[model samples]
Target: MRNVLITGGAGFIGSNLALKLVESGSNVTVLDNLSPQIHGDNPELSPLYRSILGKVKFIKGTVESRQDWNDALVGIDTVVHLAAETGTGQSMYQIKKYSDVNIGGSAILLDLMANEPHNISKMVIASSRSIYGEGKYLCKQHGIVYPNARSAEDMKLADFNVKCPVCSVSVELLATDEESKIHPSSIYGVTKQVQEQMFMITGQSLGIPTVSLRFQNVYGAGQSLSNPYTGILSIFSTRIKNGNDINIFEDGLESRDFIYIDDVVESIMLSIFKDEANYQIFNVGSGVCTDVLTVAETLKNVYQSNSSVSISGNYRVGDIRHNFADLTLIRSKVGFEPKIDFLNGIKKFTTWVNKQEIQKDLYEASIQEMKSKGLYK
Candidate 1:
């Protein structure tokens, strides 16, 4: 049996992975701080944490602690680093918090790898599509070009589409490939970029195989419903749970590639065992773009709630217009393909959400917090 260490193993993606690892007979160890935002004040209050209680070893602490890393690394042969602050809007104002957790936490791992000796054979890091800021677009005059972030002035006029860099004409956002540009629009994105770079660079020099997964909008069961800072679906569902209206931002047409959690876990397992995936960065997405309007409508119908959908002519800073992953590279290299489509995945997610105790919706408060910081407009 292999020894696997999953940092942030209590969160949605990480917890699901931990379950998979435990069932497969791998000796599993979870290292997480159980941030109050995600797990509430008492971590044991979370069903996800309770599920893995008897199956795997658990450690509660921040990754920034060298002592915690030293402890979590004990007898661990494979590592999957998923610990971080994930709020895109909050990352803008809490610059030091995001940097300290994401970048600084990653530095601790690299430092330990450089100094300490262990049996670590491979590592898998959780990266994000955020690094591909305003990713690829087809410009009539410029062929394929990566545009800059959408302007606030354009949003005020309700012109929410991404424009061509050269001709300034509206452009179609295309599926981003692994070789696409690495320009991240948010501070969170920048930190993620640095996080992956440190792992790959340090892992290589230390003779450890590494895989950086650029995951796109992962959602499914066990997603935190109360955390308004992340998981749009969870936020929307919680609002609907409280009989609140659904607020659609940016004309309700901004699109993203949302992959189901099972598919993401499948891709991670593939990277863990495949020799060909070493020293590679792969994009894990459904390879299909689903617009925000479609998602809002779908969730409303599934929940059968009376909440009306509002296409608010509002926008937030550091948000991307549209992005989807070109999963060709990962498919070719690791033979990974998404089995759960958006509609089927939504049904499963809604089924799970219905069983849980309805959380008090904090959608407005989250917006107000961002608005106070000038992040929301």
Candidate 2:
């Protein structure tokens, strides 16, 4: 059995992945700080933490500490590094915190592997689609182009679509391939980009096979319902449950490639098993773009909630208009195909949410924070 260590293993994705690894006969070790944002004030009371209570070796630690890394690396054959601050808007304000944890923590891991002695053979780090800020697009005149960040001037006028860099006309959304430009609009994206690149480069130099999976908007059961800084699905669910209206951002047309949690876990597992996944970056997403309005309406329908859908024409700085994955690379490399479509995925997600207690709606406070920072319009 492979002795695997998963950093941030108490998180939504990490916990789910840990359970699957344990079920597959792998001895799992989890190192997580249990941030109060994701896991309420008392992490021990979190269902996510409790799910893996006695199943895997759990360590309460942060990735920022060198001692913590050393403690978690003992006897580990494979490492899955998933610890990072994930709030895009919040990262703009908390730049130091994101950089310290995401980039600094990753640097520590790679430095230790370069200098220290260990039995780790393979490593997997979670990269983000955010790395491809305003990713690939098809311009009628320019063929394939990568648009620059949408201007706030245009966004204030309610023009949210990404325009062609060459022609300045609106462009068509293309399936962002693995080779797309690596420009990140937010500090969170920048940190993730640096983190993945460090792991890939360091892992290759050390002859330790590393895989970077650029996951797109992962959501489903076990996701933090109280975390208002990220995960619009969870935020919307909480608001709907509380009888509050669903506030849609950017004309409610801004789209994303939402991949289910199970699909994400399956993709990671495939990368672990397949030798071809080494030293490569793959986009893990549903490959279908679903707009914000559709998501809000779907949740309202699924939960049969009385919450109205409100389009406030508000746009956050560093937010993308629309971008989805190509999926050809991941599919060809590790034979990964997403099983759950949005319709079915929503049903499954809502079913799980129905069983849980309604979390406090912290969405307005998060917006106010961003607004005060001048990131929100």
lDDT of 1: 0.92
lDDT of 2 by residue, 69-179 (tens): 999999999999999999999999999999999999999989999999999999999999999999999999889999999998899899988999987899999999999
How does model 2 score by TM-score? Answer: 0.99
lDDT of each prediction vs. the true structure?
Answer: 0.92, 0.94
Mark the regions of model 2 whose C-alpha exceeds 4 Å error after superposition: none
lDDT string, candidate 1, 1-377, tens digits: 78999999988888999999887889999999988789866778888888788888999988999999999999999999999999999999999999999999989988988887888999999999999998898987889999888887888899988998787899977899999999999999999999999999998898899999999999998889889889888988998999999999988889899999999999999988899999999999998998888998999999998999999878888999899999999999999999999999999999999999998787899899999999888
**Position 48, candidate 1: lDDT:** 80
Each candidate's clash count = 0, 0
